[model samples]
Target: MSKALTSFLGENLADLKDKGLYNIIDPVEGPNGPIIKIGGRELINLSSNNYLGLATDSRLKEVGKQAIDQYGVGAGAVRTINGTMDVHLKLEETIATFKGTEAAIAYQSGFNCNMAAISAVMDKHDAILSDELNHASIIDGCRLSKAKIIRFNHSDMEDLRKKAKEAKESGLYNKLMVITDGVFSMDGDIAKLPEIVEIAEEFDLITYVDDAHGSGVLGKGAGTVKHFGLSDKVDFQIGTLSKAIGVVGGYVAGKSDLIDWLKVRSRPFLFSTALTPADVVACTRAIELLMESTELHDRLWENGNYLKAGLKALGFDIGVSETPITPCIIGDEKLTQTFSQRLNEEGVYAKSIVFPTVPKGTGRVRNMPTAAHTKDMLDQAISIYEKVGKELGILA
Candidate 1:
């Protein structure tokens, strides 16, 4: 109702549209899976983060519904209050066990977990060396800490070492922390955690890893820290219930004292309503499944390799992805969006990602291969990519 506010939004939205930066969110007609129905059309889904396809698993669905029936749809209050249900404790315990940490604390979402955890531990007197290509939530959380944020080049160990030395030797801040994504979501590259840990140890830097994309896909489903045999060395391991867990929430798994401090001091846990009983229970079961077997994890990597090989054969630059995430790099933003749109028309559903999600002129149609995608589905998607690429002059 405020004219000035309306005018500001109108101008910005028009600017976004003109710059090809406005995102059009699509609605799925059914559950997200290997194949999803969107706007009444069935397409092989390559745009989702449902890495293990647990989002639509029958077992998870059943457990979620059971919780809804027994409890309710909502948590009803913040965690510091009546919202801390028995199921919440169980989910945190499950996270701690899965992450191989002494304790863990859950939050309303992965983004919230970053916001709460960072500010809870670091402040203006601290400095953080963050990955240049970390997720948006990590950037926001670091900003919230009011800490002096320094960005190291993406996956450049030498730069990280130099920065760590500078920050540590400066001795101007009360503490120095280094944070990075366990897996770089855009390029599907695994972080060089081994070297990062080495630098951290050398500089006495506190360590934090946002393992959202690596939770169920790395370290035999434990995570990136475990992937590098640094479970005990990592001070904070952040993860999501929404992605591979196929539920909703986020958490920080760390030392018992850190967990206790987060419970009492994290703003989101203290101010926001907790995760629902259904979400908590479903997440717990997901972790259990991950711990019990590596079937899904193996399948996910298989699918990823299959897709990547096919794309590479067809002359697509997939960047330097070391994981199941595939990006068909299209240097122009509008062309990238057009490539994705044409794929959807041809029965594949990969979305275009451009600046500021990625650097300018490096827009891409990113694909996330899940454990549940059949060979036929992947083959079909690859064929579609070829057809679209040739037609659009992207391939010879």
Candidate 2:
């Protein structure tokens, strides 16, 4: 390494430390679930994205083990070369059916899916109207597309309409697309998809919704598109198997042509190795479970509601969240970090989110109550929150 580069990195690292923005990773000692062990202590985990608590489910593990026994552990090569397995096709088919689309394609991760799909269609000649609060994957994908990115205020239909009109009127682009997250992760807010679809229709723009956090949460586990009954109207529905599905991989559900085009053009799909057979099988089984019954989803909602009610009752400022994601807004970054630290010390595993992940001075500790969390667990978390809030002067 160059000495100059090393010096620059050292300076930047020191700056982060000085500002109390440097984070030290805390390792989870066991399986991630509703409750997790960290640093030899078990805590009620409200920081995980495993919405349905499927990450540690024994059923998924059995399916994964069976696939491994049958097909081994790896895909061996990229899909375009020789890696496409029967399980991959089956998973895609399952995703298509779940999203009510003609076809679907899977990628290594949700982030890779966005990076691949957005650039596959939209290019330098195209313009993309994107939500300001879209996931980082979407932002990176838009950048990779080399398109003119027009940002609209988060969930602001009027701003989206204004930007859409401007982009359409300029005639400076060959294609126009609007993209947003189906459910924002930080604030746990649902996107205004119905209004967005109406705007897309008026502007003749292709619509895309990344439902990474929505799948297995909204629409009885079908997703936000299905939740809003706009499955047939949205052009692209992106989802992940990592969170609620308790597996790994990302997929894009859309018309057959779009899937076909992505298979041929998406660099990640063409060059990166496909998902392992076990992952594909486990993901398929997870979807099957979701379709079979709404028990898990309903339980998740109950847990979410319980936690939200408990938090609000404790006099914490829970933001305007319409989903299982509840945020305790603490404002200052240092205080938010301290709050999270105290929660962990008190046997509650809620993580603090500060600037860059969220807006400045709006730092919060996001709580994700999964289906596996019992009422007693939530009650304990609320008690801990109250204690921490009082000690820190956050609550009267």
User: Highest TM-score: which candidate?
Assistant: 2
| Prediction 1 TM-score vs. true | 0.98
The digit string of per-residue lDDT tens for model 2 on 1-396 reads 999999999999998666657677889998999889998999999999899988998999999999999999998999988899999999999999998999999999999999999999999999999999999999999999999999999999999999999999998999999999999999999999999999999999999999999999999999999999999999999988899998788999999999999999999999898899999999999999998999999999999999999899989999999999999999988899999999999999999888778888998999999999999999999999999999999999
What is the number of residue pairs that collide in model 2? 0
- What C-alpha lDDT, on a 0 to 100 scale, does residue 16 get in candidate 2? 68
Task: Indicate the residue-level lDDT of 226 in model 2.
Answer: 98
TM-score of each: 0.98, 0.99
Model 1 stretches with alpha carbons more than 4 Å out: 1-3
Query: What 10-residue stretch in candidate 2 is worst by lDDT?
Result: 15-24
Candidate 1 lDDT tens digits, 137-239: 9999999999999999998999999998998888888999999999999998999888888899999999999999999989988888888889999999999
- Whole-model lDDT, model 2: 0.94
Clashing pairs in 2: none
lDDT per model, in order? 0.93, 0.94
Clashes of each: 0, 0
